[model samples]
Target: MPEKLTNIRNFSIIAHIDHGKSTLADRFLLHTKTIEERTFHDQVLDAMDLERERGITIKSHPVRMHYDADDGRTYVFNLIDTPGHVDFSYEVSRSLAACEGAILLIDAAQGVQAQTLANANLALHQKLTIIPVINKIDLPAADVDMCLEQVEELLAIPRDEVLKVSAKSGMGVKELLEAVVARVPPPETDPAQPLQALVFDSVYDVYRGVVSFVRVVNGSVKVGESIRFFNTDLTTEVKEVGYFSPGMKPSASLLQGEVGYIITTIKTPGDIHVGDTITGYLRACKQPLAGFQHVRPMVFSGIYPIDTADYEALKANIAKLRLNDSAFVAQPESSIALGAGFRCGFLGLLHMEIVQERLRREYNMELLLTYPSVIYHVFMRDGSMKEVDNPLHMPDPSHISHVEEPMIKSQIIAPATYLGAIMNLVMDKRGICLKTDNVDHIHVMITARLPLHEIVLDFYDKLKTVTRGYGSMDYEPDGYETSPTVKLEILVNSEPVDAFASIVHADRAVYRARMICERLREAIPPQMFKVAIQGAVGGRIIAREDVRQLRKNVLAKCYGGDITRKRKLLDKQKEGKKRMKEVGNVNIPPEAFVAVLRASDDKG
Candidate 1:
């Protein structure tokens, strides 16, 4: 029994974006013959259409491969390929927890990036063995020596241990797999103990219900056995047990130290939570496994359907999507301007964009999104605290004591020549430079602290622009600090639009207000009466723009009329315009809201 566990090597591949993690995963499957030659393609693990089109791994993919080692021994390898973007760091962490070691890949051309360091630290914190590898040696700009030196100097790893491989060309991958078997220790678990499995990922199937991807730490789980989730305390009979041979392959049982999925007949998507432990229903473990920390959403926005009748359908679609993405959250909410919709929260801007795109493409739902905002802690004068993510829920000025905003400690890597520009860009976002380190002759790393609200928009895009697409950024949440913030409300013809309300810092409120007003002026068409687009902070107008009213020219037929007649007609027209202004309803087009959001992204 112990010998079986000794032959199992579980590890994951982690790296920065575009560093060839998925390509490397494909190579492994091909080399091991886990996939047929006729069925082989690029990025075989990325099954989603959106992921293939974007060329990024949005979800972590796991597969089991059996490799015949040079020592004439057969070994089973459990490989997990993870996403490299900052927003998907949670996915990477969960994947790391299921493995015994991690392959840290660095692009030969782009030596060490911000996310590269961040992911390395996460693995170090978890105490997983790290294998440094240099990828993309086939590129013309590959600097293998510089990357190896940087790995030693910056990552504090020995240069001799680092491996060089071209994932695209499948060079040296065999040796890399051999190294994994030699270096990465096998899982230490006892088959005689009670069932204790960690749920790292899960998905909902129409026919099978909830299929949980788990790593069994102790004992074995099989069909017809009753299991209970440690977190939710929900019990259900295991319908089937299986392993991923790049696809589902049902097995008799998942033994100790093996990675596989379990089909629970539970149809509710929210019943099975990620990071929950699965144990025997009759014989439970004394203590639950140390699961992952709860994910806190960093950004919030309203997702309304263009057609109101799709509310129930949209809700069901979101529930299905959330089954795969545990980080994306949603709650039913109504807006005075946008009507019934769902208020969704995401990890970052990119995550939000992907979810919106998924809904549009996967479910065929047309959506209207409002401006994104971060959660703010509002301390009321009555000795109470409230967490506000929606601007419409902000308490009155007299009842509020102070506001605390979320901050982040960001790590940015860029070329040395663009250091000045990067510094200025950080400063513009109301951030303070903490320190700067020279990574090499050409690359520099800068650490800074910035308000979460400032970078929730286009900060990353700006950083890339200044660094000429050579910059990368990673951030961690810092505790909130007391900041003077005001609720900026957009009033169209004196009627407040709840969807257009936002919380802004007092000092920059005027500039942000001006941007919104200008965009609205351009987007809104001329009305029958004069329309006023005003940005107000606590009832005080800070920015204003007017849309000129359309005139029918009441005097067009008065070619040669008396002066009194002309005056009478003009006075009558003025009285009619005044009445129209009082009762007229401004039909704001959906495009106007889109324009305002686009403008806010530039100035947020």
Candidate 2:
């Protein structure tokens, strides 16, 4: 039947954030009879409430289905789902590389944005058979003709080649499936070759450590075979091989041109990684199949607990969390103030937020997150090197002797009216403009080389504010470069507080320092003892504030009571004294530490 389903389609839905990629995939799942139609009024494959509530897919997953074409024939559809955040760009690339085709979803009303262009570029780079689909037609803001024109002009494809569909209303989905069957070629086959499967994405199962999702490029995999992961020489016997049916129904061994899961009892999550090659152990190491590449994380930030007591708990939770999420990375990091957190790399800012939110929500651990810091290589006085994780830990420019910072190639799209504002903001952020072009109705595309550290904190918010929420910024972390920066440390009572340190351009250091002081004033609670706040530079205080004492002391008294009340009052005062934080000879309330630590987040 149809060459043993080798002529079947294996494709992924890829798009920018909030562009209805998952929504459209849900529609496909419904139309294909994979699940009861519209069973999930909410997102279908976004099985977790966390994912649906956030309206973003954190983990990549594949949903299997069969679509009946107007030709009255069936095609097995392996719809690979990918993350929309740039942090998962590698994951997106891996998913795109697994398939022969990709459906590019463009919002009709908003037209093309920064990420749309990016994902389109990645698809074209992988030489994918792209079917441009314009979605969200039900909205009054829909501009089908305009978005199609943008796609045709930007992607250099024919306008008529693009398909129009309303993913939300489920209109045009059947035709879209037909277009996929007609235009998208079946998986390339060379069944005789030795088995070489690409592990595009994977997750950990409680019973089995990692259930890796693989796309078989050649041969076949059966149960009880000796298999080896490319990156890891670690060999394991395949416990079972299962292919995805219309909605994960059980099917025996997955053959060439199939999407399926492999249950290997690999001891830990570290054994499995995305984009790894899973090949049968043979007489010699067989060459990898046609498509695969290494994916690099573009952004990084440190995650630490607000309370030192929660440090181990945070570590345990992060370890557990990373098992299922192949993208989340963690490494030990220590700051003078924060002690130990993780310097974790991500694909983008959205990726960082997702990890942080999960840690807070899922684990119920309150954390004091320093401004997300990018990786920077610094040359020290001892002729050695250190990778700066937290900007707070960045040595003084003088002590650093010489410093280099990371820079990223960024693209910004904003309305023509805000071009000036955008330009000014970019320049202020130390961005070196690369190119400027006018597109749809004075929409301007400006490319700039920006310091990764500059935008590590709240660049999105900053850009949005500057452009009145019309700024669309897209960046893939490039690499470290030499740049001028000053590391300003925030202090309490002249003692260096590593949590308050940040890296800023030399010119902007003063303003940032003052602003940090103001934030500390808001964040640092009025304490039992007078506490001083200072922003220090080169071990010298640049900005300072003195938080006054609590309006009332730890006075516990009864209006009409016996001497026993006095004893009770003494006991409370002793207990309260024991709970106080010693900040440079001042006994601050326990809540004061939490208030100050969580203050930065509040301002955020």
Candidate topping lDDT: 1
Off by over 4 Å in 1: 190-192, 309-312, 558-565
Give RMSD (Å) of candidate 2 vs. truth.
6.4
Q: Once all C-alphas are superposed, what RMSD does model 1 give against the true structure?
A: 1.6
- In terms of TM-score, which candidate is strongest? 1
lDDT of 1 by residue, 1-604 (tens): 5788989999999898888888899999999999998999889999999888887888877899999999988999999788778887776787888889999999999999999999999898778999999999989999988887788778999899999999998998999999999999999886567999988888878888888999998989999999999988899999999999999999999998999999987887778877788999999998878845677899999999877898889999998899777789999999888889999999998899999999999999989888889999999998999999999899999899999999999999898899999899998888999999988777888999999999988899899999999999999988899999999999999999988899999988998888888889889999998999999999999999998899888998899968999899989998998999999999988888778765636556
Give the residue spans of candidate 2 off by over 4 A. Answer: 245-247, 283-285, 289-302, 306-309, 332-343, 381-384, 391-401, 521-532, 548-584, 587-604
Structure candidate 2, residue pairs in collision: 87-347, 87-348
Report every candidate's CA lDDT. 0.90, 0.76
